[model samples]
Target: MQSQQLWTVRWLNAIGDVDREQWDKLALPLSTPLLEWQWLHDLEASGSISPRYGWQPYHLTLWDHEELIGAAPFYLKSHSGGEFVFDHWLAQLASEYGIDYYPKLVGMSPATPSVGYRFLMAEGVDKQVLFRNMLSAIDNSCQQQQLSGCHFNFIDELWFAQFPAHDFASWKHQSYLWKNQDFEVFEDYLQTFKSSQRRNIIRERRSMSKQGITIRPLNGQEIGTDMAALMYRYYLNTNERFGPWAARFLNGDFFTRLFQNYRHRLLIIAAYTDSAAPPIALSMLLVKDGHLIGRYWGAETQVKDLHFNMCFYAPIEWAINNNIKTFDPGAGSPHKIARGFRAVANTSLHRLYDPRLKILFEQIIDQANDMESANIKALNQQLPFAKNTRPV
Candidate 1:
C-alpha cells in the first residue's frame, strides 16, 4: 500500500459543477440539514450570499491519492451573528483580550441552523482518519491566512467524539424539538397537554378560523417569485418591529429561486384572510424525508395570536398530519412549550485554538450544559398538565 498525499479542499459556488451523484451520496447521511440540491445552488447563484456579505463558501474535501473520500460544507465568516448561537459576546471578549475574532473559519451548513454539520465522508473511508487529516488541513488554512478561530456550529454527533482532538471549541447551543412516537393524529398528540393548555390551542385555531384566517401549505413550484418578495417584505417588517437582530440570512431572490427549484422539499403554510384573494401572513417550512422544520414567518399586519398560530401551531399540525418524525420550530420561543413543542437537547461542538481561551470556555461549557440539563428537567416538570397527568 502506497501512502500517497491525499485529501484536498475545493470550493464550489454551485453544486452543479460538482459530480452530483457522488456529492449527494455522501451528503445524504452526513447531515440532516436538507436534501435540496436546487435550493443550495440557488443560494450560490444568487450571489447575494457570499463572503461579500460575510459568508464565503469554503467546501472541504478529503482525497485518497486520486479519489474523493470526504467533503464538508463550510464557509469563511466575517462575523458570528447569523449562526443563531450567540458568539457576539465571545467576539467582544476576544477584542478585549486583543485577539482578532472577525473573518473566522466556520464549518456549518451556511444560513441554516438545524444541526448536522460535519465533513461528508465517502464509503470505505475511515471517518476518523478523514476528520484528523481534514482538521490538519483546516488548521493549515487558518494559520496561513492568520485568521481567528474556527467554528463548527450546530455540529453532528459524529463530529462530537472527534472534534476534541482537533482543538475545536464545544459550545452548547439551545435547541428544542417535538417528536412523534406513533402519534396517529393531531388530537392524539393534544391529549398529552393539560385541559387548559389544550383549550387555549383550540381557541387560537378557532379564533383564526372565525376571523377567516385559513392557512394554505404550498411547495416550491406552487410558490411564485411574487410571493418570494412578499415573504421578504413581511420578514423585514417583523424584524423591524421586533429587533434588528431578527433579520434573516437570505434575500428575496434566494427565496424565489429556492421555491422554484426545491419545491419538493418545501412545506409553506400561508395564512390568508378568508375574504382576501391571497395570503396575508406567510410561514415557510422545509419538509425533507420524515422531518418538518419551521424556518421563517411574517405577517403584513399583526393579528391576535398570529405569530403562534402561523409559526408554531399550523406548521406543527401539518407535521402531525404528514406523519413527520420530528418538528423543529426554528430558533427560540418559550411560548413553544405552551403550544406542545417540548424541550430537547441539541449538541454543538467547538474547537478553540488558543490554549488559555480553551481552558476558560471548557469551564463555561460545563456550567452551561448543567444549566441546560436542569432547565429541561424543570421545563418538563412545569408542563401545564396536572402533576398526576401522564404525557401521551
Candidate 2:
C-alpha cells in the first residue's frame, strides 16, 4: 500500500509574506481581480486593512512539500462593516441567545462586494480533497481560537454548488448585475430598455453634454499619480458626505499603492469640463478577463446627472466597447434597476461554533433564503427592459 502524503498547513498573518508569483499563480486563473496577490497586498501594505480598523489578515495556505498548492485569503474581523453581506441581524440574534459574535473569521476581499470567492487550488490537484482539508483546518482553528464562526461572502456559483452545505448554512443576498446581451454599441444597449426609460436614459446622458462635461475612460497606465490622488480625495470626500453610513474602509495609501503597482486591472471613468481642468467626478472599476467591477467614486464639483453617467452609463458603454461581459456596479442603489441592472442572488456561507446558534441558523435559513429569492424576483421584475426584450 502507498502511504498518503500529508499536506502542510500554514496560517499567514499577511499576504505579502507569500511570494507574489506563487500567489498570482493561484489567483490569476480566477475571474476576480480583487483576489489577486497585488490587490490584497496593497490593502495590507497600505494599512487600509489592519488590526486598528478591525480587519486582521489571517490567510490560510497549504503546501505540498516544497511547492505551493492551495490558499484562501481570510480576515479575523472584529466587526462586520465591510463584508457587504450584512450579518448584523444574525449577530443580534446571537446576542439575544448569549452568543459572542465579534472576532469571527471572514473570507472575502476586504471592502469589496464583488463575488467569486473560493480557495485558490493549483492545477492538476484533486480540488474536492483540497477543499475538505481546508475546511477541516478552518473548523479546528475556529474551535481552538474560540471564534464565533467562519463566514464566506459573495461566493462564486460554481463553488457554492459544490460547497459542503452540511458543514455550513447558506445565506442569500442580492446584488445589482448587468450582463451583456451581445449589443454591439451603446445605443443597442439603450434599445433593450422600454421606450419611456430609453428616452430618459438618452436625456440623462445628453444632459452631461449640454453641461459641457465629457466623460472618458482612463484605463490602466492612463491612471497616473495626479488622477490617482484626485480619486483618493474624491473617495474621502464622498465618504465624509455620507456621514455615519459611509463605507470608508480604505485610505489614501491604498489608492496610491494600487495605482503604482496594480494599474493593469484599473479603469477610471472621469468627467471633465475643459481640456485643462481637473476631472470633476470619477468612478474607479476593476477589470479582469471579461468582468468589470465598480469600486469607488467621488466628485469635486456637483454636476447634473454626473453620478448616473460616471458610475453606470459611461462604464457600461466602455464595457461594451471593450467587450466586457458583466458589470457589478458596486453595492446598494436600488435605482440601478431603472437603468437596466438586474437584482441577482449572491450567496454567503456561514458556520457557527456554538451549537445553539447553529441550530437557530439552520432552523431559519430555508425560510430566509426563500424570502430573499422572492425579493430578488420582485426586484428583477421591476427592470426597465422592453416587454419584448426581456433579459435572459
Candidate 3:
C-alpha cells in the first residue's frame, strides 16, 4: 500500500469548494447518480443538507499537487434524520455507555436510501491505495475530533468486503431491488410473477386507466419549472401523510434547484387525466447509466391504485423500453415484494473510535446481521415470482 503521506488530504466544508468538472470526473463513472457532483452541490446550495437541518457538509478530498485524485462526500450529522439506515438502537446503546454519538462523520448521499456508495476515485489511480489512505484519514479525523465514530451507509457491495480489513464492522440491512431479467416489455415483466400476482398487477395497472388516468414518463428537456414546483408540493404532501415516519428533508428550493441544474438525470412519471391538462400526480426518479431510483411521489388527490401504477408499473415499463438494468424503488415498504421487487442485502460499515462502543458493536453485530439475513430470506420467500428467481 502507498504511504498515506503521498496524497494531500483536505476536508471540504462544502462540495461547492471543489470544481464541478473535476468532481464529476471521479463521480460520473460511478453506477449511482446520487454521488454526482451536481446532486451533492445542489443538496448543499439549496440548504436541504445544512447545519440547521443537522447535516453539515464535511466532504473529504485527496489531491496530488493541484489535481484531484479521490473524494468522499461526508456529513457531520448532529442527528440521524435523513439517513435511512436506522441506527437509533445504536445511538441508545451509546447513550447507555455515556458516549456522545451525535456529530459523527457519515458518508452517503444525503436523504437517498439507494445503494452504490464508495470512495470516488479518479481513473488510472491506484484504487486500493486511495481506499486505504481515505480510511486512514477518516479514522484519524474521528479520533482527533473525539467524535463518536464514522459510518459509511448503503455501501457498494463490491467495496463492503474491503472495510473489514480496515477494522470497520459491517451491518446488514435489506432493501428492495427489481432487476431487469431481459424484460422486453411490461408484459414480459408481468410474466415473471405467479398467476395470482400477475392478475393482481394487471388489475392494479388497469385501475388507473379506468379512472380516466394515464401515466407517462417525462425525461430531460420535457420537464419544466411548473412540474418541478408541483412535484415539490406532492413531496411535501407525501411526507405530511407519513406524519411521524416522514423523511421530509428536502425543501421546495431543493426541488427547484434540481430541475434547474440536474434535469438531464431527472425522470418524472406523471399521471394525467387529459392530454392538455396538468398532471394530477407525479413520481420523480433519477437515472444514470441504465440504473433508476424511484425518489418521491405525490398526488393531487386520492386515486385508486394510482401510486403503484405511476411509481412502479409505469417506471418499470419505461425502464424496460430504455434497457435499464436495475430499478431501486427507494426505501421502505416490504409490500414492494408483491410487485416483484426482491429483498436484497444492503450493508453499512461502522468504526467506533471508543473501545467500549467498538466492543459492544462487534459483540452484537453478527447476531444482528444474522437476524436481518433471516428476515431478508423470509421476505424473498414471500416474493410472488413464478419460479422463485430471487438473486443468490
Candidate 4:
C-alpha cells in the first residue's frame, strides 16, 4: 500500500499543451466550443480575457509525475463581469471590513455561463487529493499576492454533490433550460402552453414578421463581415444598456479568428431591416450535435417583441427544424419560464481559506438552494400550461 506519489502544479500559456483528446476523455458532460482549446486560445489571442484587461490567466494544473491529473480554469480577476453571479455584496463586505476582494480566483469558463465546471482529473487519481492540491496551489498564490477567496460559479450538479465535505459552498442560481422530449416541430412546442400564452408567443412572432424583420440563422461561415461587425455594435449597445459587465470580451479580431477556426459549432441568427437586409438584432449561439445553446444577442433598434423573436423563437424553430435536443438559453431572467424554458438546477463549487467565511457562505448557500428549489416549484406551477399538457 502506498500514496499515489507527489504532484506538481503548472501553468498553461496555450491550451494546446492541455491535450484536447484527454480533455474529451475525462469529460463527463457535453463540451462546448467556448470551453475548447481553440476557443479559449482565441479568447487570449484576440485579447478577450487577459491580464491586460484585469483577467490574468493563472490556470492551475496538477500533474502526478508528468501526467495531467487535475486542472481548472483559474483566472485572477480584477473585476467581475462575465461572471453571472452577483458578488458585489461580498466584495462590499470585504471592503467595509477593510478586506481586499479584487484579484480573487475564479474557476469558471470565462465569458460564458454554459455550466459544467470542475477540476477535470483522471479516474485513477484520488479526487480529494487532486482537489486539495489544486486548492493548495491557489491558496499559496492568493496569500503571496494578497487576494480574496475563490469563487466557482456556474458548474454542474455532480461537482456540487462532492464538494461540501471539502468546505466548499454551493451557490444556487436559476436559469432557462428547454428540454427536447419528443418534440419534432414548432407546433408541438406550442401545444405545451395554455392557449393564452401560446397565443401571445404566436402573436409576438407574427408581429415581428409583419414588421418586415426577417431573421436569417447564419452559421459562422455564412456570417458576412457586415453581420459580424454589426454584432460588435450590438455588443457595444448591449453593454451600454447593462452598464459595466457588458463591456465586450474579445475585440473584433477574436470573432474574426472565431469565425475562421470553429465555424461549424456557431450559429449567428440575424434579424434585418427590409431596405437591404441590414441587421437590427442578432443572436450568436454554439450548436453541437443535437443541442442549440443560446449565447449572445442584441438589437441595434428597440423593436417590440424583437428580442423574443430573434433570441427565443428563431432558435427554437431552428432547433425543431434540425431536431436538436436541449436549448440552454444562458442564465438570468425568470421571464424565460413562460417562454417555455423550465426550471433547471445549475451548480458551482468553491473553496475558502477563512474557516468562518467558509461556514458562513456554506450556510448561506445551503439555505439559498433550499429556498430556490421551493421557489422554482412555485414558478413551475405558475407556468401557463393546460392541465397535464405541461412540458416538464
Candidate 5:
C-alpha cells in the first residue's frame, strides 16, 4: 500500500461541491446511470435522500496536490430504509451485543440496488495503491466519527474481488435479470421457454388487445415535461396502493428534474386506453450502454395484465428491438420469474468496528450465504424456461 500522505482525502456533504465535469469524467464511463453526477445531485437536491430521512451525505473524495483523482459517493445512514440490501438483522444483532448500529458509513448510489460502484480514479494512477489509500481514509474517517464500520453495497464484481484482501466480509443477495442470448426478435425469446409458458405469454399479451389498451415506448426526443409529470402521478399512485409499505423515495420535483436534465437516458412505457386518451399506466426506465433498468411504475386503475404488460412484456419487447443486452427489473416480485427474469446473485461487502459483532458476523455469514444461494437456485429451477435454455 502506498503512503497515505501522498493523497489528501476530504469529505463533502453534497455532490454539488465538486465540479460536474470533474465528476462525470469518472462517472460517465460507468455502465449504470445511477452513479452519474446529475442523478446523485438530483437525489440530494430533491430532498429524497436528505438527513431528515436518515441519509446524510458524507461523500469521500481524494486529491493529489491540485488534481482530483478519486472519489466514493458515501453516506452516514441512520436507518436502513431505501437500501435494498436488507441489514435490519445486523442492527438487531448489534443491539444484542450492546453495540450501536446507527450512523454507519455506506457507499452506493442512494436508493439504487444495481451494482457498478468503485472508487473513481484518474488515469496514470496505480489503481491498487489508490484503492488501498482510499480504504485507509474510510477506516480513519469512520473511527474518528465513532461510526460503525463501513459498507459498500451492490458493488462491481472487480471491486468486490478486491475487498476480501482488505478484510471486508461478503454478503450475498439476489435480483432478477433478463439477459439477451443473441435473440433476433421477441418470438425468438419466447422459443426458449417451455411450450406451456410460451402459450401463457401469448395469452397475457392478447389481453392488452382485448382490453383496447396500447403500450408505447417513448425515449430521447419523444419525452416532454407533461409526460414526465404524468409519469410521476403514476409513480405516486403505485406507492399509494401499497400504503405504508411503499418505498416512495423520489418526489415530483425529482421526476421533473430528471426529465428536464436527463431525458436522454429516460424511457417511459405509456399504456393508454387508446391513442385518443391519456396514459392510464406508465413504467419509467433508465437505459444506457445496452442495459435497461426498470425504476418505477404505477397505474391509475387496475387493468387485468396491465402490470405485466407495462412492466415486463412491453419493456422486454422494446429492449429486444433496441438490441439491449440486459434488463434489470428492480427488486421484488416473484411474478417476474414466470415472465422470464432469472434470479441472479448480487453481493454486498461489510466490516464491523465492534469485535464481538464482527465475530458474530463471521460465524453466521457463511450459513446465511448458503441459504440465499440455495434460494436463488430453487427460484431458477422454477423458471418457465426449458432446462436446456436456462443460463448456465
Candidate 6:
C-alpha cells in the first residue's frame, strides 16, 4: 500500500494511456453516458477532437502506488467552439486584460452540454481531500505553463456545491429539460399543455402522417452500419445548413464506431416514407440511467413540422415508452418551450489564476447570474402549459 502523501498526478496526452478497465472503473458508475470510456475514446480515436482541431486531450489521472484512484477528463482547448457554455465574451475580456485565453484547461465531456462532470474518484476515498489535491495539481500545471485559467463546464450540481470551498466561482446558464412526471403515455404528456398548445402539438405530430412519413424508433441490435452511415449524412446536412453556426464536431467514423460499440445506449428516431423505404429524416438520442439526451438530427427533404416530429414528439413518446425519467433536448431553440421543455439552470465553474481577472469576474458574475435567473423565470412563464399543470 502507498502512503497518502505519495499520491501522484499524471497528465496524459491520450485517454488510451490508461487502461479501459481502469477508466471505466471510475466512469461506469456515473449517471451520464458522455463520460464513459467508449464515448470519450471514440471522440479521440475518430479524430473528432484533436490538437489540429483545437481540442488536445490532456486527461488527468491520480495514482497511489499501483491504484488508479481518480481521473478528470480534461482538454487543452485552443478555441472554445464546441463548448456550449459561451465564453467568447470572457476570451475578449481576457484579451483586453492582456491574457492569452487560448489553450486553457477545460474539464467536461467534449461536445456534450448536459451536466454530471466531476472528478471520478474511487469508492470510500476522501473526495474532498482528493478534490483539493487535484485542483492544486491543475493550478500548478496551469501556472507553470502560463495558461489563463481552468474552467469546468456543465458540472454535476451535487459536486458543484463542493467547489466554493476550493475557491471556484459559478456561472449560471439555462437549458431546456423535459421532466417525466410519472407520465404513463404520450397523451398524459400532452395533458400538461394548454388547450391551444396541446392542439398544436397534436397537429405537428399528425403532419408526419399527412406527408406519408412514418417515424420509427430503433435501438440496440436494430441499428446497423448502413443506418449509422445515413444518420451521419443527415447530421452533416443539418450542420451544413447552418454554415458558420454549425456545431458538427463528430465525423462519419465516430458514428460508425458509435453504432458498432455503443448501440446499446443508442436510440434512433427515423422518419421513413414507408417500411420498405430509407429514412428521409433522423434524430439520434443517447440514453443511460433513465435519462435521454438529444444528440443530433437532420432531414434530407423539407417537410412541414418534420423537424418537430423527429426531434421532439417522436423522441418524447419513445422516452415515455422506455420509462426515461428526463429528456434533455440539448441546447438552443426557444421553440422547445412550447414543446413541454422547461427552462432549467445549468452551471459552469471557473477559477482564474490572475487576480485582476478573478476580481473582474467576481464583480460581474453575480449580476450576470441574476440576469440569467430572471430570463429563466420569464421563459418558464411563457411555457404553453396550463396554470395548474406540473412538468411532464
Q: Which pairs of residues have clashing backbones in candidate 4?
A: 155-347
- Writing each residue's lDDT as its tens digit, candidate 2 over 1-392 gives 11116678899999998989999999998889988999999999999999999999999998887567889999999999989988888899999998998899999999999898988988877877778878988999999999999999998867657755546788999898999998799998999988999999999999998998888898877887777788999998889888999999888889988889888999999888896989888899999999999999999966778999999999999999999999999898789999999898898989899998888889988999999999999988888888789556
* Tens-digit lDDT string for candidate 1 (264-367): 77787788776356579888888776888788788889899888878877776777777788888877767777776677666666666666556666767788
Residue 241: error of model 1 in Å? 1.6
Give the poorly placed runs of model 5, Cα more than 4 Å off: 1-6, 162-164, 387-392
Q: Where does the lowest 10-residue lDDT sum fall in candidate 1?
A: 1-10
- Candidate 3's TM-score reads 0.96
For candidate 4, write residues 337-373 as lDDT tens digits: 8888887777666666555555556667777789878
Off by over 4 Å in 4: 1-7, 13-29, 64-67, 122-132, 143-146, 159-165, 243-248, 273-278
* Model 6 misplaced regions, further than 4 Å: none
lDDT of 6 by residue, 1-392 (tens): 35569998999999988889988999888889888889999999999988889999999999987788989999999999899989898889989989888889999999999888999988877888888889889999999998888999999978757656877888999999999888899999999889999999998888878878888999999987688789899999999988999999999999998989999889999888878878898899999989999999988967899989888898899989989999999987799999989999999989888888888889999999999999999998899888889644
lDDT of 5 by residue, 102-197 (tens): 999999999988877777888778777788888888999889888877998898877557645778898999888999988889998999999999
Number of backbone collisions per candidate: 11, 0, 0, 1, 0, 0
lDDT of 1 at 38: 57
lDDT of 3 by residue, 264-370 (tens): 99999989999998899999999999999999999898888998887889999999999999999988788899998889899998988889989989999999999
Off by over 4 Å in 3: 1-6, 160-164, 388-392
Clashing pairs in 5: none
The local distance difference test score of each candidate is 0.72, 0.89, 0.89, 0.75, 0.88, 0.89
